[model samples]
Target: MAESKIPIYGAIGANVAIAVTKFIVAGITGSSAMLSEGIHSAVDTFNGVLLLVGLHLSKRPATAEHPFGHGKELYFWSLIVAVLIFGLGGGVSFYEGIQHIRQPEPMRDPTWNYVVLAAAALFEGTSFLIALRQFRGQARGVPFWEALDRSKDPTTYTVLAEDSAALAGLAVAALGIYFSHALNMPMLDGVASVVIGVLLAGVAVLLIAQSRGLLIGEGVRPETAKAIRAVVMEQPSVEGVGRVLSMYVGPDEVLVVVDVDFKDDTPTGDAADAIAAIEKQVRARFPMIRRIFVEASDAPGGDASAARPGAAS
Candidate 1:
């Protein structure tokens, strides 16, 4: 995910160029589609800044107050990104698009509009490819759907979604530019702007949904659970696992609580030794699991000890 940030930054850099160019082209041609594309690119620039902030904040060291680490901050900030997308990006574009539809302005110098769109599309495509390449390495060893379904790093997903939308929006912009040029109708440009707005809104909604899950402290993925269980159960002296609780507190960190039973009767000292061994094994197996709380199962006739006291029922 760290490496993936490079492409996101690159995409942001390119958007700055694209946005400025589009603004100039839009003003010169008076094409609503170009203006809308400019707005989309502008939002992308802001999203990049937020993504950088999220990437940094999400990596903060765990504190006494937040033993789970600062991973959840990624999701919270990402949720803010979604809200901005919806309110600032989507709302503004939607309003502008409606205005264009109501009183369509005739496009002037439509030829230049097409040229600017083509250039933007190329730049956006390049940025998108870089992001895809970055994600490729991170996504390996994990199922495609699973990576997206369980990933806690909002920067990667948000950038990917934003890049995809930018590419699509550029294509629509090109079409609108063409039609406005061929048919001498500027309303087509406005219609294209509306389409771009809808796309941004849709992606924003998705970001909101994902961020909400993270903020609420979603549990680990099923595959991750299976892996953790397997690791815990592999010790020869273990009888069976009683419970394995895991939650995402950050992008690459998890809080783990496990309960296990011993295979046979053992002395108090031996039980302590076994617990220590199990803790060491679990840590070695899961470097990503930063915090682990283990408790020995109750003796045959005794009550269980709490690993995480006051855990939700």
Candidate 2:
């Protein structure tokens, strides 16, 4: 969890500096795309702060009111960040773009816009590389989109998404500024702002979907569930493993409940011992499983041989 902070901090720093620069440049150049970019950077800066707050709150110790700790606080805040991206970042940009298009302004010299765009790209690119490196470490060998879908930590990926959008927006802004000046089509700058808004909205929608799923409850990956099932079935005294229910309680915490059927003639003491062994082995294999509940069943027709491995609820 601590490692997740590195990229977020880097992003916050870059966005803060860039936001100030973009706003100043926008005022000087009256470029609609530059103003939209300024808003985007400001929103990103705030989002980074919110993410850090979420991370800090999520580290709070569990209490009676919330037995699972405050882990989901991170998800909640992530959801908020997504909404803000859609509202303040995307929605505002769209509005500004339309307004600018309706009342087209004269094209100004794009020299400052070009300079700021170049510098913003440098900072944003560096931040993106940091976030991508962090995400790659977590992804191991998994493909990019697949790993992003499987990731539980939002900080690294969220920063990556934001930086990607920022870099893309810079490109669009540069093009808009160039075309508007060269072709005497000032409305093109507004078109660029709208495009940037669309990009941000798309990114926000994806983040919202992921954060919502995690907040509701997401289980471990299929491979992980299968491995856990195999571990349980390896016990000699165990007859069958039923539903292996699991959910992520936090980025690094999982709660698992397993239904086990011991051999019909196995002694209660032996079953208890088997349960203990299963718990130990499962924890050893997956340190993220913080809480485990094992239920020994004696009901008739308890055969789970036909049950698919890791088909947990």
Candidate 3:
């Protein structure tokens, strides 16, 4: 969580520099593919700024008007990022590609496009590596895809996906420029621009799906819920476990409800002691779990008893 800002900051700086350089080179060469690369970099730069703003807004302290704090602000901005990519990056490139295909303008001084593409690749590659490292760290022992699915922090994986797409777009732009000159078919450059746009569109779709799921309140992973059950059941005072629910209130912050059956003969003092102990143990075991609701009932492991008011055994 502490390392979340690095990718956005790095990408912002790198994309800003690369965007300017690519625009200059595109102007010099008059390559449609080169111009598309410039536009891609510019869009990425803007997205980085949006992400940082989201991070800041998400950090706001909880108020009466917004008791949950502004954690979901990140999700809202991430969705915006997706829409922007689809509109500005993909839509514009698609329009430009088709226009260029019809016009078929020959590229002049194409060597400069190659130079700018190489530089952009280097910067994008570095940002991608940083994002990949953070994502791997978050995965822990789980499979990468599973970790991505369970992860509450969208910022890390979003950066990784965006940088990955950026790198791919840069490579496509270079190839398009090269093949257009080599084969003497200016239309190939236009095709390359369309391909870059397609790549961005795909990435946008992925980000949108992930952000939407988060906003809709996807619960804890099966493994995590299972672990929570084990922790509650292991306590001596617990007779049996019932329904256990987990919800993420923020990245690295979870609100949990664990229903347990206590021995009939257990005194109120004993139940209180057990509840306190369970809360402490669970919090220590999973730092992400910030709040817990443990209820006791006469019956064990039934939906009827799960919803019934809990009484002291």
- Tell me, by lDDT, which candidate is best: 2
Taking all chains together, the TM-score of candidate 2 against the true structure is 0.93
TM per prediction: 0.88, 0.93, 0.90
What lDDT would each prediction earn against the true structure? 0.78, 0.88, 0.82
Measured with C-alpha atoms, the lDDT of residue 2 in candidate 2 is 69
| Model 1 Cα lDDT, one tens digit per residue, 1-313 | 5585888788888999999999999899888888888888898898788878877887787689975567777787788888888877777777788899899987777788878888988898888888777776677778767777766777777888888898888888888778877898777877888888898899999999988887887777777677767776776566787777887787777777878776556455555656666667666776667677776675332435624222211
lDDT, candidate 2, at 195: 92
lDDT winner, 2 or 3: 2
Decreasing TM-score order of the candidates: 2, 3, 1
lDDT of 3 by residue, 203-257 (tens): 9998899788778876677887888888877777778888888767677777778
Flag regions of model 3 displaced more than 4 Å: 140-146, 299-313
Candidate number achieving the greatest TM-score relative to the actual structure: 2
Residue 158's C-alpha lDDT in candidate 3?
A: 80
In TM-score terms, candidate 3 sits at 0.90
Show the colliding residue pairs in model 1. 71-250
Q: What ranges in model 1 sit over 4 Å off?
A: 1-4, 141-143, 280-285, 299-303, 306-313
* Higher-ranked by TM-score: 1 or 2: 2
Query: Candidate 1, TM-score vs. the true structure?
Result: 0.88
